[model samples]
Target: MSALQIFVLALVQGITEFLPISSSAHLVLVPVLFGWADQGPLMDVAVHTGTLLAVLVYFRKDTVGLLLAALGSIGIVPARRAVAGSVYGKLFWALVIATLPVVIAGFWLSASGLHAVLRSPQIIAGTSILFGVLLWLADRYGPRVKALDAMALKPALLIGLAQILALIPGTSRAGITMTAGLALGFGRQEAARFSMLLAIPTLIAAGTLAGAEIAASEDTMLWRDALTGAGLSFLAALGAIHGLMRWLSHAGMTPFVLYRIALGLVLIIFFWTGSS
Candidate 1:
């Protein structure tokens, strides 16, 4: 990939990964729109790794608390009763339970090769518009009383189930999970925060799988390109995460919904015209 292609793909990944807009859709669309080749799995792994780092940095305090909370629960760190009994401890379990559905689903899809079959522009357009509407409805009508402190098993499971849809090209993991959070009456910031935290495990699962593929493949991937993409994506993702959290503090998901709908419609037109 040229520098321009690397820069554009990295920028798109960083910005859209955490938003209610579908990052996977954007990544798929951008290449087709520009007539560029697929950025390949190595690039996917790199950009995702970068965003993972951004989430870890932005939520550093929560990440540490959750880590301690997990250890406390497992009796790894003895006499940490207070941490074990706190909300973070509960949240750690909530996250674990929440991550299970998607992991199973992803593995199934990979084994069946159905994941590749679902990567077309038509699928993306349909999912983007459909889920975008869902987000709008959830944000407009769902009660916003609960915060992260209120996270529990039921809500976490519901949100995790919703995340399974994210395996579809345009059904964004962040978007669907946030929609579930809002529909469950969590506030916008709270929903976004949990969605991001949930991404930690999801990204790890994805990156690990991608890494294994790259390692086993005969094709040589350019480490230079991967590193460049990772570095640029990291900076872009950090800024995007910061911007999203600040935006949610005072606003809602309306703008992102509009963007998703518009992008979906545009992709639909592009798909039809190209097919004709």
Candidate 2:
């Protein structure tokens, strides 16, 4: 990949990974729209690793608390009452439970090869528009009384189930999970925060699988590209995450919702015209 291609793809991954816009869709569309070759699994893993690092660093405090709490839960270390009783403890469990649905769904999709089959532009266009509308409805009418601390098993499971829909190209993981959070009454920032936290495990699982593939292939060019993509994506993702959290407090999801809808419609039109 050229430097420009690397930069552009990295930027897209970083920005869209955390945003309600589907990063996978953008990744797919970018190559198609620009006539660039597919980024391949190695590059995909690299950028994902970068974003994973960004979220881990951005939420380091929370990550540590959750880690300690997790250890306590398993009796790896002595259980601290304070840790056990804290929001972090509950959040740790919530994240674990929320992660299960996607893990199972991803396995099934991969095993069935449905993940590859659903990567068409038409699928992306339909899902992008459909979920964008769902996001708008949830944001507009859903109650906003709940905070992340209020996350419970049932709601977290619901959000996880929503995340399974994200396996479809345009049904964004962040978007669908946030929609679930909003519908469950979480404030915008709270919903965004949990969605991000939830991404930790999901990204890790994906990156690991991608890493294994890269190791087996031993592609030197892919390694170089992956390294470049990872560094650039990390920087971009950090900025995106910070900006998003700040913006959500003052402005809601309107801008992102509009963007998703517009992008989807454009894709639909482009594909329809080309086919005709």
Candidate 3:
């Protein structure tokens, strides 16, 4: 890919990855809309790696606490009652539970080849609109009183199930999970925060799979392009995460929901016009 294409695509991946907007839809549609060639899987892996690193770095303290708590839970370290009752231990298991459904569904869908078939603009447009409405409803009407400390087994599993919908290109892993979190009464920042933390494992798994494919392929991996994509995406994602968390404290999900709706409508119009 050209440097311009690399930069734009990486920026899109970074900004949308953690947003309520569907990154997959933008990744697919950006190339088509701009008449650029497909970015291919290696680039996808690289940009995803960047977002992974961004989230890890942004939440380094939480990551460390969770890791230590997990080790403590497994008896690898001394388990403190205080730590056990804190956000770290509860969130560690919550993420593990919330990550399970998507991992399993992703494997099944990939094996079935249904995953590829669902990548069309038509499906993306439909999902974007549908889930956008769901997000709005959850945000507007659902109780927004609970904090991350209230995260528990049932809600985490429900969010995981919602995450499975993200297997559809425009359903948006972050969007759907945040929707579930909102519906479960989590405060806006808390919901967004947990959604981002949950992305760590999901992104790592996806990057690893894509990396394996690159390793096995005969196609030349452009190290320069990959590194550029990674760095640019990391910077963009860090800003996106910070800005989003800050915004959520003052505003709600209305802005993001409207964006999703507008984007979905535009895609629908584009597809309909092209087909006609």
Candidate 4:
């Protein structure tokens, strides 16, 4: 890949990974749209690693709290006295409940080989528009009475189940999860916060699986490109997270919904014209 390809792909990954927009869709479409070679699983792992780092750094306080809470639950310390453990402990368990569904679903999809089969432009266009509408509806009508700290097992589990849809390219893990959050009465920013936090484990699992695939393949892992992608994506992801959090404070998901719709329409047109 050229420097420009690396930079563009990394930027797209970093920005869309967090936004309600689908990062996978953009990554797939960008290369096809530009007539560039597919950026193999190695690069996917690399950019995902960068976004994973961005989440850890941005949510360091929550990360530390969750860590202490987990340790406390494991008897490494008194649960009551551990930093933020009293509440974060419950949150820790809630996140666990939320992560299980997708992990299982993802494994099943990969094993069935449907994961690769679902990566077409038609699927992307349909999901991008469909889920974008879901987001808009959830935002427009859903009550915003809950905060992140108030999260419970049921809601978290529901959100996790919704995340299974993210296995489909344009369904968007962040978007679907946040849509579920909104529908469940979480405030917009609160929904986004939890969505991002939830991404930590999901991304780790994804990166690990992708890394393993690369390791098993005969294809050489280009460390230089990986590092460049990771570095650029890290910076872009951090900025995206910060900007998105700030934006959600004042606005709803309307802008993102519109963008997704527009993107989907454009993709539809492109594919239709190409086929004709």
Each model's lDDT comes to 0.88, 0.90, 0.88, 0.90
In order of listing, the candidates' clash counts read 0, 0, 0, 0
Q: Give TM per candidate.
A: 0.94, 0.95, 0.94, 0.94
For residues 148-205, could you state the per-residue lDDT of candidate 3 as single tens digits? 9999988999999999999898988889999999999999999998999999998888
Off by over 4 Å in 2: 78-82, 213-218
lDDT of 3: 0.88
Per-residue lDDT of candidate 1, residues 88-186 (tens digit): 888998999999999899899989999888989999999999999999999999999998889999999999999999999999999999999999999
In the range 1-276, model 4's lDDT, one tens digit per residue, is 899999999999999999999999999899998999998767887899899999999999989888888787778855437665356888888899999998899889989999888988989999999999999999999998998878999999999999999999999989999999999999999999999999988888767876676566664436678778988999999999999999998888999999999999998898966788
Off by over 4 Å in 1: 78-82, 210-221
**lDDT per residue as tens, model 2, 107-155:** 9999999888898899999899999999999999989899888999999
Question: Which residue pairs clash within candidate 3?
Answer: none
Q: Output the number of the TM-score-best candidate.
A: 2
Clashing pairs in 1: none
Q: How far is candidate 1 from the true structure (C-alpha RMSD, Å)?
A: 1.9
In the order shown, the candidates' Cα RMSDs to the true structure are 1.9, 1.5, 1.9, 2.1
- Candidate 3 Cα misplacement greater than 4 A, ranges: 78-82, 211-221
Locate the minimum summed-lDDT window of 10 residues in model 3: 76-85
